[model samples]
Target: MWVLTQKINEREDKNFSRKCLLCRLQFKGCRADYLSHLSRLHNMQLGQPENLVFIDDLLNCIETRLESLHCLFCNKLFKNQTVLKEHMRKKQHKKINPKDTEFDKFYIINYLEMGKNWRQVKNEPDDDDDDDELSNAENSDRRVSVGNWSDWEEDEDKVENPVVCLFCERSSSFDEIQSHMNNAHGFDFTRISVDMDFYHQVKLVNYVRRQVYMGHCPYCDKILPNRRELLEHMSMESHFIVPQMQLWDQPEYFFPTYENDSFLCHLNDHQDDMAELHLSKKMEEDCHIGSC
Candidate 1:
């Protein structure tokens, strides 16, 4: 009977500790202080706050709310422009996501085999023009005869920019093309290509071919199921507009500046720091339990 009573009292004490001390109208303390006050004053056993589920969600919410923020992907917290630039080099946001597309692949393969030497000057094929000379030459080459080039040439004028990316070969405007190169193929466009054949051939091709790409918006980090959804995201205010300048330019590659004001620069750093600490504490607790 004594043991049963003791057990019941213990459960009651635990439940009392779990209630939010500052949650009531009478008390208006923050979560940490209220929890601490309850444990210390009422001799209550502390447990996790009911509202917070995963630490990531809590941290993310807190992080967005703060005034000065850090890059979530990079550890660099930005109070100013100088700090942000330092972060970009160290964090290398360009490297994290390779924006490879199907069109990039076609462009790269075709560019490697056939240089950008030919231009289709005429829209109409002249019946009197010499098809026999080109056909005979093509027929002589054993490997080149594999695919129908004439059929490809007929439709080629419809497509702009045949220079296929090793990752995607779609005809994107020049501004968007570099992003495809960096994100999908893992080619740092700024770096000088040491081995032209290797860059166009083995290294770049192997980089993206090995991995399965689910296309994501570079600005919002939203992974869409299809290209249509990605296009919709690109048009919306939430997504970063691809700058008119070359993608390799520091302004385009680093800070996503649609306007003079920056959203990332004005993030909540303190809240993010606090949330990270809280998460670290929880992880430590979990690890301890697991190890034991």
Candidate 2:
């Protein structure tokens, strides 16, 4: 769980004074403990700690945002320090925005994979799963499976993350992100989600992520320099919404930022119904799994 806070070849110690901007706590802490604190308290996580680098810069940028009265998750502004603290505390927005490109450098997967970014890695089918596809054995049990539920059920409760906003840093329980997005952001999810299957929903989200990261308005195509300005333009024009279905449904957004992004799991309302069918289906069929 050791996070690389400094460049790889740096001579200075990596485990220097690390700060938790969300919690307003400072500690001369080891990188591992700090990462654990972030995961446990904030539902904020990057890739495996070993695959990360220059984590300190990533954190410092977040800290600077907080000090300047910006909402860490959504980059929304507040009137003053007290209101900003209350907004985050009440909304539980302690996590990082997975869509934000500011974090892409810290993750090694983006660099390791030639054509794909780290976020896309999870969406692509794993090579190991392509086993014995053409095994035309005499006994071909179409109902055959490779693994069981027990493997995933181990510590299932601990694995479930606090509900995080798909579009913001807010982390809450009892599905508060839904209400926040619908009410505060005017996201007509129920209205449009009917047209989207689970995978379509994921792509749509990633499409929004891409739009925000690229400073393009998903609704209008107007470009801004940063997320804050883009949001301001969108909010000013009431553009917090989906564009035409064809525009968002692209192959690129198929890969999500977090493999087990709990927010993504919540996208499919019919998860229970889908689970039973998935278990009984053939092992060679398309494999799509997400956990938090």
Candidate 3:
């Protein structure tokens, strides 16, 4: 329950000696040394509130520290939860047997709870049967025995409106389209866009892509063959549009056109002025196209 922010170390001194609040033992050197002492000597239980508070405080005292988010299973560090979640999904971290390693057991439990909370926040259906099926799929040891890419291809072939990559015009299944867009076309869904249509397009693409990847309809729990089918089904169902707009829009998504070559050359030097100029140009183009 104790959420330690990334700024914990900023409050600590560089040459400061640490004293264990529990043992009252004064020690010199880094906070990690003291943490090791606490772990080795006291066998601090992270689950305990009192222990967590002490550990949290101890961690705050370190000048230099490891990355905030880390996966012990893969021995990797991530800058944030978003990056960590993507890594977990790609690596199939949830599919790994926790019983194989102590660290895996501890981390997997926490992550699963986090995932459940996220699903709840999204208002996803709470189906015990679906949960059990997923649990069984993950627990199975034989990875090769699971569903293959050929199954996805077959599903795509059956769909009347197959998902096609706009960038490269490649036909791909719903599950594989997003990865294909990222890896092949270098399409970044996270890009900032000023145009509302472009923004909505990005959101719709990601939303449908995720639903397809999960093998279910977002509006209805009905199973879909591929993302193409899901999109068509959603369209037939008349699912209301709920654009997943970003908190901050990026200006780079708009193609800037300048009235003068000099203005374009010095655009980076005067970002504010260039933004205003670009907006005016965009408005004029929009008006011209609308009149036509």
Best by lDDT: 2
Ranking by TM-score: 2, 3, 1
Count of backbone collisions within predicted model 2 = 1
Model 1 C-alpha lDDT per residue in residues 1-292, reported as the tens digit of each score: 4434433443334322233321121333344444444333222222333322232233333235222544434344665433443454233331111122211221222232333311222233667767535675566684565566787777644423223432343545323445666665444443423323211322222222222144655444467786666656655644433222222232222222222211122122243335556776787789999999
Q: What is the lDDT of residue 208 in candidate 1?
A: 27
Better of 1 and 2 by TM-score: 2
**Candidate 2: tens digits of C-alpha lDDT, residues 114-188:** 778867887876578546365655235432433455655664434246765655566765257778888877886
Q: What are the Cα lDDT values of the candidates? A: 0.36, 0.64, 0.42
**Model 2: residues with Cα > 4 Å off, grouped in runs:** 1-160, 269-292
Q: Which scores higher on lDDT, 2 or 3?
A: 2
The alpha-carbon lDDT assigned to residue 48 of candidate 2 equals 52
Q: Which lDDT value does model 3 have at 55?
A: 39
lDDT of 3 by residue, 1-292 (tens): 3233322442253454866522335777654555554443333323322222233443442212223555423547765444543454344342223333332222223343554532344466566776545555466744654556677667534533244653234664434654675565444332422233433433344454444566566445568776677656656775423333341133432222211111111111123324546766787789999999
The TM-score of predicted model 2 comes to 0.38
Candidate 1 all-Cα RMSD: 27.3
